[model samples]
Target: MVAVRIAKETGLAIDRVTFKSSLTLDKATLKAVPAGQCVTRVTLEATVYGDVTEEQVTELGEKVHVCCPVAAIFRHLPGCEFEPVWTLAKAE
Candidate 1:
Protein backbone atom coordinates (compact mmCIF):
# COMPACT_ATOMS: atom_id res chain seq x y z
CA MET A 1 0.00 0.00 0.00
CA VAL A 2 2.86 2.37 0.78
CA ALA A 3 4.42 1.65 -2.59
CA VAL A 4 1.09 2.04 -4.32
CA ARG A 5 0.56 5.41 -2.70
CA ILE A 6 3.98 6.68 -3.64
CA ALA A 7 3.65 5.38 -7.17
CA LYS A 8 0.33 7.15 -7.44
CA GLU A 9 1.88 10.34 -6.06
CA THR A 10 4.59 10.07 -8.68
CA GLY A 11 2.02 9.18 -11.37
CA LEU A 12 3.83 6.02 -12.27
CA ALA A 13 1.62 3.16 -13.33
CA ILE A 14 2.77 -0.10 -11.83
CA ASP A 15 2.24 -3.83 -12.18
CA ARG A 16 2.84 -6.43 -9.49
CA VAL A 17 4.96 -5.23 -6.60
CA THR A 18 6.85 -7.81 -4.57
CA PHE A 19 9.27 -7.59 -1.65
CA LYS A 20 11.45 -9.66 0.66
CA SER A 21 11.94 -8.85 4.33
CA SER A 22 14.55 -9.99 6.82
CA LEU A 23 14.62 -8.95 10.46
CA THR A 24 17.47 -9.44 12.93
CA LEU A 25 17.27 -9.39 16.69
CA ASP A 26 19.81 -9.93 19.38
CA LYS A 27 18.69 -11.62 22.61
CA ALA A 28 21.48 -10.17 24.75
CA THR A 29 21.07 -6.75 23.15
CA LEU A 30 17.29 -6.97 23.54
CA LYS A 31 17.94 -6.85 27.28
CA ALA A 32 20.70 -4.25 26.88
CA VAL A 33 18.97 -1.95 24.35
CA PRO A 34 21.96 -1.83 22.05
CA ALA A 35 21.69 0.21 18.88
CA GLY A 36 18.09 -0.76 18.12
CA GLN A 37 17.65 -4.50 17.59
CA CYS A 38 21.41 -4.93 17.70
CA VAL A 39 21.51 -3.40 14.25
CA THR A 40 18.72 -3.89 11.67
CA ARG A 41 17.97 -3.19 8.02
CA VAL A 42 14.99 -3.58 5.70
CA THR A 43 15.81 -3.75 2.02
CA LEU A 44 12.87 -3.45 -0.36
CA GLU A 45 13.35 -4.32 -4.02
CA ALA A 46 10.42 -3.10 -6.04
CA THR A 47 9.92 -4.58 -9.49
CA VAL A 48 7.69 -2.46 -11.64
CA TYR A 49 6.24 -2.51 -15.12
CA GLY A 50 4.39 -0.08 -17.41
CA ASP A 51 5.51 3.15 -19.00
CA VAL A 52 7.29 4.62 -16.04
CA THR A 53 10.27 6.91 -16.47
CA GLU A 54 13.49 6.71 -14.55
CA GLU A 55 12.77 10.09 -13.03
CA GLN A 56 9.35 8.90 -11.88
CA VAL A 57 10.91 5.76 -10.50
CA THR A 58 13.40 7.90 -8.63
CA GLU A 59 10.63 10.07 -7.28
CA LEU A 60 8.69 7.01 -6.17
CA GLY A 61 11.80 5.75 -4.40
CA GLU A 62 12.22 9.04 -2.55
CA LYS A 63 8.57 9.46 -1.71
CA VAL A 64 8.06 5.97 -0.32
CA HIS A 65 10.79 6.33 2.32
CA VAL A 66 9.71 9.81 3.34
CA CYS A 67 6.00 8.97 3.47
CA CYS A 68 5.99 5.39 4.70
CA PRO A 69 4.86 5.20 8.34
CA VAL A 70 6.82 2.08 9.12
CA ALA A 71 9.88 3.73 7.67
CA ALA A 72 9.19 6.90 9.63
CA ILE A 73 8.94 4.88 12.83
CA PHE A 74 12.33 3.27 12.24
CA ARG A 75 14.02 6.43 11.01
CA HIS A 76 14.98 7.49 14.52
CA LEU A 77 16.44 4.18 15.60
CA PRO A 78 20.21 3.80 15.64
CA GLY A 79 21.73 1.37 13.08
CA CYS A 80 18.40 0.97 11.29
CA GLU A 81 18.73 1.34 7.55
CA PHE A 82 15.96 1.36 4.97
CA GLU A 83 17.39 0.46 1.60
CA PRO A 84 14.92 0.78 -1.24
CA VAL A 85 15.69 -0.27 -4.78
CA TRP A 86 13.40 0.32 -7.74
CA THR A 87 13.71 -1.81 -10.84
CA LEU A 88 12.06 -1.03 -14.14
CA ALA A 89 10.89 -3.81 -16.41
CA LYS A 90 13.08 -4.80 -19.33
CA ALA A 91 11.80 -4.20 -22.84
CA GLU A 92 10.80 -7.39 -24.55
Candidate 2:
Protein backbone atom coordinates (compact mmCIF):
# COMPACT_ATOMS: atom_id res chain seq x y z
CA MET A 1 0.00 0.00 0.00
CA VAL A 2 1.16 3.53 -0.84
CA ALA A 3 -0.14 6.98 -0.02
CA VAL A 4 0.84 10.16 -1.90
CA ARG A 5 -0.06 13.70 -1.02
CA ILE A 6 0.22 16.58 -3.45
CA ALA A 7 0.11 20.09 -2.12
CA LYS A 8 0.11 22.44 -5.04
CA GLU A 9 -0.35 26.15 -5.37
CA THR A 10 -2.66 27.81 -7.89
CA GLY A 11 -0.06 26.78 -10.46
CA LEU A 12 -0.37 23.11 -9.42
CA ALA A 13 3.11 22.65 -7.94
CA ILE A 14 3.40 19.39 -6.03
CA ASP A 15 4.87 19.85 -2.55
CA ARG A 16 4.95 16.49 -0.81
CA VAL A 17 4.59 12.77 -1.50
CA THR A 18 4.39 9.77 0.85
CA PHE A 19 4.15 6.11 -0.11
CA LYS A 20 4.38 2.62 1.44
CA SER A 21 3.95 -1.01 0.34
CA SER A 22 3.94 -4.37 2.12
CA LEU A 23 2.96 -8.01 1.86
CA THR A 24 1.01 -10.18 4.27
CA LEU A 25 -0.18 -13.79 4.48
CA ASP A 26 -1.89 -16.32 6.75
CA LYS A 27 1.17 -18.21 7.89
CA ALA A 28 0.51 -21.57 6.26
CA THR A 29 -1.17 -19.88 3.31
CA LEU A 30 2.14 -18.24 2.56
CA LYS A 31 2.67 -20.92 -0.02
CA ALA A 32 -0.43 -19.83 -1.87
CA VAL A 33 0.74 -16.22 -2.04
CA PRO A 34 4.42 -15.67 -1.84
CA ALA A 35 5.90 -12.70 -0.02
CA GLY A 36 6.31 -9.50 -2.01
CA GLN A 37 4.04 -10.93 -4.67
CA CYS A 38 0.99 -8.84 -4.05
CA VAL A 39 -0.04 -5.20 -4.03
CA THR A 40 -3.03 -4.33 -1.85
CA ARG A 41 -3.75 -0.82 -2.96
CA VAL A 42 -2.39 2.65 -3.69
CA THR A 43 -3.79 5.88 -2.31
CA LEU A 44 -3.10 9.37 -3.64
CA GLU A 45 -3.97 12.49 -1.68
CA ALA A 46 -3.59 15.72 -3.63
CA THR A 47 -4.27 19.27 -2.56
CA VAL A 48 -4.35 21.71 -5.43
CA TYR A 49 -4.35 25.46 -4.97
CA GLY A 50 -5.69 26.30 -8.37
CA ASP A 51 -8.77 26.29 -10.56
CA VAL A 52 -8.45 22.67 -11.41
CA THR A 53 -11.71 20.80 -11.85
CA GLU A 54 -12.66 17.47 -10.33
CA GLU A 55 -13.16 15.97 -13.77
CA GLN A 56 -9.58 16.74 -14.72
CA VAL A 57 -8.10 15.08 -11.66
CA THR A 58 -10.34 12.06 -11.90
CA GLU A 59 -9.64 11.60 -15.58
CA LEU A 60 -5.92 11.84 -15.03
CA GLY A 61 -6.11 9.34 -12.22
CA GLU A 62 -8.05 6.92 -14.39
CA LYS A 63 -5.42 7.24 -17.06
CA VAL A 64 -2.65 6.60 -14.58
CA HIS A 65 -4.39 3.57 -13.09
CA VAL A 66 -4.74 1.97 -16.49
CA CYS A 67 -1.06 2.35 -17.26
CA CYS A 68 0.35 1.93 -13.77
CA PRO A 69 2.58 -1.14 -13.78
CA VAL A 70 1.70 -2.32 -10.30
CA ALA A 71 -2.01 -1.88 -10.92
CA ALA A 72 -1.82 -3.75 -14.18
CA ILE A 73 -0.04 -6.64 -12.53
CA PHE A 74 -2.71 -7.00 -9.86
CA ARG A 75 -5.46 -6.64 -12.42
CA HIS A 76 -4.74 -10.12 -13.75
CA LEU A 77 -4.53 -11.76 -10.37
CA PRO A 78 -7.23 -14.10 -9.13
CA GLY A 79 -8.11 -12.34 -5.87
CA CYS A 80 -6.09 -9.18 -6.13
CA GLU A 81 -8.12 -6.03 -5.81
CA PHE A 82 -6.64 -2.83 -7.18
CA GLU A 83 -7.96 0.48 -6.02
CA PRO A 84 -6.60 4.04 -6.18
CA VAL A 85 -7.75 6.50 -3.58
CA TRP A 86 -7.49 10.14 -4.66
CA THR A 87 -8.11 13.12 -2.43
CA LEU A 88 -8.10 16.45 -4.26
CA ALA A 89 -8.20 19.68 -2.34
CA LYS A 90 -8.87 22.74 -4.48
CA ALA A 91 -7.77 26.12 -3.25
CA GLU A 92 -9.98 29.11 -3.53
> Total clashing residue pairs per candidate?
0, 0
What TM-score against the true fold does each predicted structure earn? 0.69, 0.50
The lDDT values for all models are 0.70, 0.46
lDDT for 2 (candidate 2): 18
Give one digit per residue, the lDDT tens place, for model 2 in 1-92: 11122222223343333333443334655567665344343333433223446665565456556766665765665544555554456443
Best candidate (score: TM-score)? 1
Q: Write down the worst ten-residue block by lDDT for model 2.
A: 1-10
For candidate 2, the TM-score is: 0.50
Residue lDDT tens for model 1, 1-90: 898876676567886566655656655677787556675766667766768877777777677778778767667667777677877767
Task: Give the clash count for model 2.
Answer: 0
Please estimate how well model 1 matches the true structure, expressed as its whole-model Cα lDDT.
0.70
